[model samples]
Target: MNDYIIRATAGNGAIRAFAATTKNTVEKARSLHNTSPVATAALGRLLTAAAMMGIMLKGEKDLLTLQIRGDGPLQGMVVSADSNAKVKGYVFNPYVEVPDKYEGKLDVSAAIGHGNLSVIKDIGLKEPYSGQIELISGEIAEDLTYYFAKSEQTPSAIGLGVLIDTDITVMAAGGFIIQLMPDASDEIAEKLEEKINRTPYVTSLLDMGYTPEDILKLILGDFDIEINEKKEVEFYCNCTRERVEKALISLGKEELEKIIEEDKKAQLHCHFCNKEYNFTENDLKEILKNAL
Candidate 1:
C-alpha cells in the first residue's frame, strides 16, 4: 500500500495526534543504503517519526532534522523532513547487523546504544531552533517521547516500529505521536496513556492492511478523534548533479586545479542518496573559472 500520514485531534482537541504508514518509504531507504535488518529498523523509526513531525510545520519550506549519535555499530542516524511530507534519511553504518534483543526481535536498542538525540527545526529563520536530550532507552520511540517531554516541554507518547522480514526487506513500518494540548486535563492524559499502551504496534497494524484513519481509530478508540488532514509521504532526496557541481566550484580555484592536474577526474558522491557524479578535467576547468 502507498504510504501516507494523518493529522488528528482527539478528546475535543485536548490531544493532538499524528500517525503514518511508512513501509514503502522505509523500503526506499533500505534499497538506497542497503541497510541491514537492525539498521533498517533504526533508520525506519526515525524516518517515520520525522514524517509525522513534518506535517506540523506552518510553512512550505520548513524542515525538521532528527539526528541520533549513539555508541553502537549503527553509529548514527539522520533524517530530514519537509512540510510537504517529503522525507529522506540514512544511517552512518547501514550494513551493521546485531542480534535480536528478546524473543528474536530486531535489536534496535542495542544497535543504537546510548547517546544523544538532537532535533533541529529550520523554519526559514536566521537561526534554526534545536533541542537536545539524552536517549532514554536507545529505542527510537522511547527516546523521542522523552525528547518531546523534556526538550519541547510537550507531553507526548510515541510508538514507532519496523518489522523486517527474514530476507531483510521491510514487512511493515509505521508510528504514531499523541501530544497533550496545553489545556489537557489529568484525567484525559491518564486515559490517553492507557489507550496508547494497550494499542498494538504501529507496524503490526499496517501489516494487517490498516489505513491511517483506521490506525487512528484503533488508538483513539472511544475518544473523539477528529481527522484534520491527510498527506502522502515518501522517501525523497533533493540532491542533484548541478548542486554537486556548485559544491566543487566552492572548493576554490586551487583545489579545482589540483584535482584536474592530478586525477583528471573527480567523483562526488552524495551521502544522502548514494548517487555519484563524475567531473572530467574539462568540467573542473569550467568550475575553476566560476570559482575565480
Candidate 2:
C-alpha cells in the first residue's frame, strides 16, 4: 500500500488522532542513506512520526522540524517535514554498529542513548515556536508522548515502530498519535487507555496490511471515528541546484572569490537527501558576479 496518513476525531472530538503506514517511505530512506539496521530503525521511527506531525500545521508554507541529539553511538537524528506530509531526514552516524536491545528487536534506545528532543515550527510568525524536553526514552514514540504532555500540555499516547527485514530492508514502519481534549470525560479517557493498551504495536498492524484508517478504527472503534483528512506521505527532499547556488551566493563576495581562487570547484552534499551539487570554476565565477 502507498504511504499515507489519516487524520480523525473520536468521541465527539474529545479525542483527536492521527495514524499512518510508512513502510515504503522508510525503506526509501534506508536505501538513500545506506543506514545500518539499528540506525534504519531509529531513523524510520522518527521519520514516520514527523510525517504525521507535519500535517498538523494550518498554514500553507508552515514547516516542522524534529531533532534528536543523543549521547550514544548514533549521535543524532534530524527530520524536517512540511504541512504536505513530505518529510526528509538523516542520522548523525548512520552506520554505528550496536547490539540489539532484545532478542528479535533493534535496540534504538541504547543506540540513541538519552538526550533531548527539539520541536521547532515555523508558521510565518515573528519567531518560530520552539520546545525542548529530555528524552524519556530514545525510542521516538515515548519521547514524543512526553514532549506533547510536558511541552504542549496535551496528554497524548504515541506509538511508533520499525521492523527490519532479514536483508536489512524495512519490513514495516508506522505509528499512531491519540490525544485527549481538555474536557474529555474521565470515563472516556479511561476507556481510551484500556483500548490502546490492548491494541497491537503500530508496525504489527502495518505488517498485517492494515491501513491508517484500519489502525485508527482498531483503537477508536469504541468511539465515533470521524476521519478528517487523508494525504499521501513520502520520503521527499526539495533541495535543488538553484537553491544550493543561491546559498553559495549568500556567502558573499569574499567567500565566493576564495572558493574560485583555491578550489576552483566545490561539491555540496545535502544532508536531507544525500545528493551532491557540483560547482565548477565557471559556475562559481557566475555565482561570484551575483555575490559581488
Candidate 3:
C-alpha cells in the first residue's frame, strides 16, 4: 500500500490522534544510506514520527526537525520534514549493531543510550520555535511522548516501530500519536491510557495489512473520530547539482583557484542522501567566475 498519514479527532474533540504507515518511505532511506539492521530501525522510527509531526503545521512552508544525541554506538540521528510530508534523515553511525532486546527484536534502545531530544519547528515566523527534553528511554516513541508532556504540556502516548527483513530492508514501519486535548476529563484519560497499553504493536498491525484508519479504529473504537485530512508521505531529499554548485561558488574565487591548482576535480557528497557530486576542473573555473 502507498504510504500515507491520517489526522483525526476522537472523543468528541477531546483528543487528537495521528497515525502513519511509512514502509516505502523508510525503505527509500535504507537504500540511500545502506544502513545496517540496527541503524535502519533507529532511523526508520524517527522518520515516521517526523512525518506525523510535519502534518501538525498550519502553513505550506512549515518545517520540523527531530534530533537525537545519544551515547550508544548509533551516536546521533537527524530527521527533517516539511508541511507537505516530504521527509529525509540520516544516522551518525549507520553500521552500529547490538544484540536483540527481547524475542530477537532490534536493540534500538541499546543502540541509542541516554541523551537528549531536541525539536525545532519553523513556521514561517521570525524565529523558529525550539524545545528540548532529556531522553526518556532512548527509544524514539518514549522521547517524543516526554517532549509533548513536558514542552507542550499535552499528555500524550506515542508508539513507533520498524521491522527489518532478513536482507536488512525495511519490511513494515508505522507509528501513532494520541494527545489529550483541553477539556479532557480524568476518566477519559484513564480509559485512553488503558486502551493504549493494550493495543497491538503498530508495526505488526501494519504488517498484517492494516491501514492507518484501521489502526485508529483499534485504538479509539467507541469514540467519535472525524477524519480531518490525509496526505502522502515519502523519503524525499531536496538536494541538486545546482545547489551544490552554488555552495562551491560561495567558497570564494581564491579557494576555487586553489582547488583547481591542486586537484583537477572536486568531490562533494550529501550526508542526507549519500549522493556524490563530481566537479571537473572546468566546473571549478566556472564557479570561480560566479564567485566574483
Q: Which candidate ranks first by lDDT, i.e. highest?
A: 2
Off by over 4 Å in 2: none
**Candidate achieving higher lDDT, 1 or 3:** 3
Could you arrange the candidates by lDDT from highest to lowest? 2, 3, 1
lDDT of each: 0.90, 0.92, 0.91
For each of the candidates, give the backbone clash count. Answer: 0, 0, 0
Model 3 residue 80 lDDT? 97
Candidate 3 residue pairs that clash: none
Task: Give all TM-scores, in the order shown.
Answer: 0.97, 0.97, 0.96
- Candidate 2 — what's its lDDT? 0.92
Error of 1 at 29 (Å): 0.5
Q: Which of the two, 1 or 3, has more TM-score?
A: 1
After superposition, candidate 1 runs with Cα above 4 Å error: none
